[model samples]
Target: MTLDTWTTRLSRSLLVNGLPREYVCRTTREMADHLEDMRDSEGDDDASRRLGDPDTLAQMLTHGFRRQSLFGRHPFLTFWLSPIPIATFLAHIVYLFTIELIMPVVVRLYGESEVAFVSGSLDATKVVLVLAMHLWLQAIPVLLTMRLYRIIASRAARPWTSIIPAMILFLLYFSMTKFELTWPSGTNPGNYRIDIGTVSGFSSQPVTQGLQALFVALVCILWLYRVAGEQSSERESAVTAIP
Candidate 1:
């Protein structure tokens, strides 16, 4: 019932209701000020009497401030399905192509006397870069997918509408997508291949990658559920505190 307690509850509710952080902070500060003024004039510590319940106030504020854009309304279609994954794949291709173009220039920079040294250095560098790129390629999609899921969970009335379909798409991408970088040999410029299907032979790599992706997805889901539970507890306590 205290001003700080009321404002804290209101802030959480506003965020859960999809109001932006800036808007929520501004509103909470303004409301706290108003509550202080009311307390000074009326000599009452109970904020519910001045501003109504925080949950109800948050609902009203959210109605005014929460505006859904095309992306917000259709997060699955805009974020999860097409552009992000496709764009990431294209970016990976572009990155590999750039490395291919640069390797020759790098090799040329060394003198004939340093040919052995240059080749060894280039091979080492290629190995490091390939490993880095592989990790990057795998991590980016998972990070992006989880980020989108978090946004939807925080803002959407029914987050699963976007989350379920997105999860499915991401799992498919994780299982099917593969990248291979071949280091340069004597005459062959280093080459890279991107594949999106089953490997020719039975391999454990896809299964391992799929399990990793599933673990990440599972962790995110559990975390979101915990957050939701905490928010519900806060809301319930706020309601009970109201006279």
Candidate 2:
């Protein structure tokens, strides 16, 4: 393989093996320099042979680094079975409470003003706040959970162990949680509701959330499959490139 292709594969292997980006970049540069020197002394043909395969090199480089941290060494335990889920739930509660406290104060302060500009600005602000809160309450938890799942899956030896449960948890959370923001009418301060369990009603909210969760899960699965395929291809190319 060409030197450029070799280095490119090496960089990807390093990243897949969980080395930090800065470290991978620095190491790739050093390897390229070493290869250049080897070529100068032994010619192009022998240089790559002596330099070793990218996948093997990446394994050796990351072996020590991976053992340095608990998260790196035991990603499934540290991330999947940890307190992160509870913390995320509590954080959402705190977020709702803060919004509840702040919005009423904001309305009381601005709701009484007779100035046309102030009234118009309050209406616009209310609209923006409602939209922002709706999106955040619905999307943030799923996004955050999936993000953690990605990190853990990338580092864990058996990714499916975490991926399935994580997806299930995300779907449940999305379906159960309810968030509503009502705009203030004249002489009345606005109100917001955040619920975390099933409501006794025939509502479409659960169905909508279910569909959204499924779509997000499908997308994440596709992305993981693509990444796995690319990594496998890179390894095959690296192996075949060996003389």
Candidate 3:
């Protein structure tokens, strides 16, 4: 086949492979005009050359089309290439260690001034309960990351777009929970209260928590989106360059 024909064929295949099965034929057809235009461009010859051979082109098309990991790839590379799952797992661990273990001990050690302002023994109990709730909240993102990874791995779809929806969900959940936790005097039901006598600081603890969650979630989302966009764009550029 001519280089132009190969360019059109391979680009179409890649676009098709990068989409879900149900969208495969649709995506292929949608890309046909663009791929043909790419072939007609003066740069098409150079672009087709980079695709290597039929075997390599086929492998690229098949990649992420299946739900399995690329066999024999380096484990270290996978961690970097697919960092979402690892990051999610680490976030859960931090939540457990900080809230379940560290925060309670710190609360006990520093007196009420060092901790969130709560009223009576109920404050202490609420603190514990709130911490637990926070930990549970983190699981949402972790689960989202896992689902995102599976979708990208299976369909070769852009994972970065997935982060956008996940982040929207995260922000909404945190906002709702923060409001719920704060309105009741920033106290949740639990074993003990804040020992109102030891309290200081006029800050609204619930608001602080909410703002913190918002900041962190926003940062994560933005960073993920930028990275995903960059990588996706680079793939498209590569396809265009190969002739």
Q: Compared to the true structure, candidate 2 yields what TM-score?
A: 0.56
Displacement of residue 34 (Cα, Å) in model 2 is: 1.9
Preferred candidate (lDDT higher): 2 or 3: 2
Clashing pairs in 2: none
The best candidate by TM-score is 2
How well is each residue in 1-243 modelled by candidate 3, as lDDT tens digits? 555565556554554344443444443344454446666774464434544654355455555343344412332344244454454454556555655666666667646543443333445555665555454555444445545454544343433343454445444433333322333344543332221111121234556555645655765556676666765775566556544
User: Cα RMSD (Å) per model?
Assistant: 7.7, 8.0, 12.2
Scored by CA lDDT, what does every candidate get? 0.59, 0.59, 0.47
lDDT of 2 by residue, 210-230 (tens): 554565466556655765686
Which pairs clash in model 1? Answer: none
User: Across residues 23-45, which tens digit of lDDT does each residue of candidate 1 receive?
Assistant: 66678878878887888888887
10 residues in a row with least lDDT, candidate 1:
112-121
Supply candidate 3's per-residue lDDT for 180: 27
Ranking by TM-score: 2, 1, 3
Q: Which ten residues in a row have the lowest lDDT in candidate 2?
A: 113-122
